[model samples]
Target: MTRFIEIRNGRVVTPSCVIEDGRVVIAGERIVRIDRAAPPSTRSETVVDADGRVVMPGLVDLHGDDIEEQFAPRSGAETDPTTALATADRMNVLHGVTTKFHALAFEESPEDGRNLENAARLARAVDRGAGALGDNRVHARCELADASADAVAALIEEVDVDLVSVMHHAPGGGQYDAESFERHYVEDRNWPAEAARSAAEERSGMDDASQGQRIDRIGELARRVGVPLASHDDKGRDDVETMAAHGAAISEYPLTLDAARRAKALGLATVMGAPNLVRGGSLWDNLSARKAIEAGVLDALCSDYHPASLLAAPFVDTGESLSTRVNRVTRNPADIAGLPDRGRIEVGARADLVIVDPSPTPTVERAFVAGSEVIRASAGSGAAPELPARSRTR
Candidate 1:
């Protein structure tokens, strides 16, 4: 028997318009109907009174790395992959992210535990935890300067990777200025000043020939596997053109307005981090996402490192219609990620929805994935759920 659920009297946010006093009917894993008039509820159907709350499609986060927090909560503490992923899944659903791409970085960073081997292990863990609530996918971040192309290609073949983002995080360019690079290495990584300086100099002096070869090989592999390709922290027009030539259809976190505009002109989807929108600026002091949105250069917004930002960023005063702002987190990212089944409240779409109360902070009251409720506000009071307990390992 197909499961039936009816959510009535909510403000349904569609891609084209908002339906006031709307009703959404879910049958099994798909949405069967969405109308202003409530369909007659049968005894077998579970009826939920949304009380005029905002009922919108669940978010599609293309580049969230919050899972890294679960994997390694601190510098030395590491949780088992399965447990970490399970925790991450619950957190994502609570934040209305039904489809999330875990942006795992393949860099030569044994000090930080973000090495190629760890990337492969985490991908395997994501594969094993397939039964989790949200659609967990892998977005392999191939560091052009550190990871070998052959290793990335092998990892892609070994795991069910969904997206591949080519990035060159060398110091003195592309997301890191000289001063910021030194600060990050010394403060964030806890490296000594001399060691950090030496590493930055070495990275800055890397041969372009080797970097280009690695980029070409990873691009070819992504193309061959049919995974969507993205370029991370693009610097300018030339960087955009280079990524376009390498077959990257998505430009993730372009560092400058010029790069974003150029990527849009080149017909690549431009993705910015949602935290930038909520915080009103970039943490790295780069281009502002709000400015990109205002200039009509931004195509989508991801959770980036903060999953909660994905849910609240759209609700910020962007001067656009609710549907248009909502699409930044929903349909736009889904379209960029090549997922047609979700990110919409249309008929026959997957029933991934979030019921949110537009309070001061905008609480996620309830959430569903494929017609099944995965997160519900505690006591139906529209309060956020308490953080899950973490077991300490000696």
Candidate 2:
């Protein structure tokens, strides 16, 4: 039997919105019909009065590093990965993120043990959290030329890896010149002189011939896995062109306007950090996400390192309305990722919806996933669920 959930008396917001008294009919986790009136033949099973609230489809987050934040709430500080992941998952779901892509990258590991352990732990936690009553998915952004490709392939084959990318952060090329790399290492990462010197000493051995061979091998692996590949921090048109030729369809955080322009021209979806849009510019002093959105080069906005930014982004506008800003993070990312089934309130789409009440300031009132309420106002009434127990491990 097809179950029906009738959401009536709300403004259904989408790419095009309808501010009217209406009913959204959900039949077996999919919206079967949306009409201004209830059908005469069948009585609605569940009726949720929206009270004139704005009812919209749940947001889709293509890329988010907030797991890193929850794991390491402070720099050089570590906590239980599972606990952190669970907390982050609840926070995101409550904030209206129905589909979240948590990119777990293993970088700067001199030994393979720590990287492997972290990846396994993250994969387990994501699986648990997603299976729980939350919105989360692990998108593994594996560095192709950084780690042994065999180790990475094993990870892909073993774990629930969704999205993979070919990233080459080696110095003196791809995204950073030698000078920029030095600045990023010494200044940004706060690496000591000896550590930075040791890392650079190894990269100094990679010649163009060897780099080309490595790139080709990585590209071949991506094709073999049949996973969507992305290029990170594209610096120029040539870099975009090279990656596109290698079958990468997404360019993440293009550092220069020229790079972004070339990516759009090449029919690549450009993803920018929402923190960059919220903060007004890039932390690395590169091209601003807001600027790219305003210029019409940016297609999607990811949470990057902050989960709350995804909720806060809908209220932001780059000289456009709030609805427009919301679309960039919602419908835009979904379309770019080729996920047309979700991200909208149209009939036949998933019945994931979020209701926001901005009486005083913007706040998420309630959130639902296919007629299941995940968050309610009772949490604010001091009946909040207990925080999960933390387990200790390295």
Model 2 agreement with the true structure over 70-122: per-residue lDDT tens digits: 77654566678778787777778767787788877655443222254565577
| TM-scores of all predicted structures | 0.94, 0.84
lDDT of prediction 1: 0.85
Best by TM-score: 1
lDDT of residue 114 for candidate 1: 68
Worst 10 residues of 1 by lDDT: 385-394
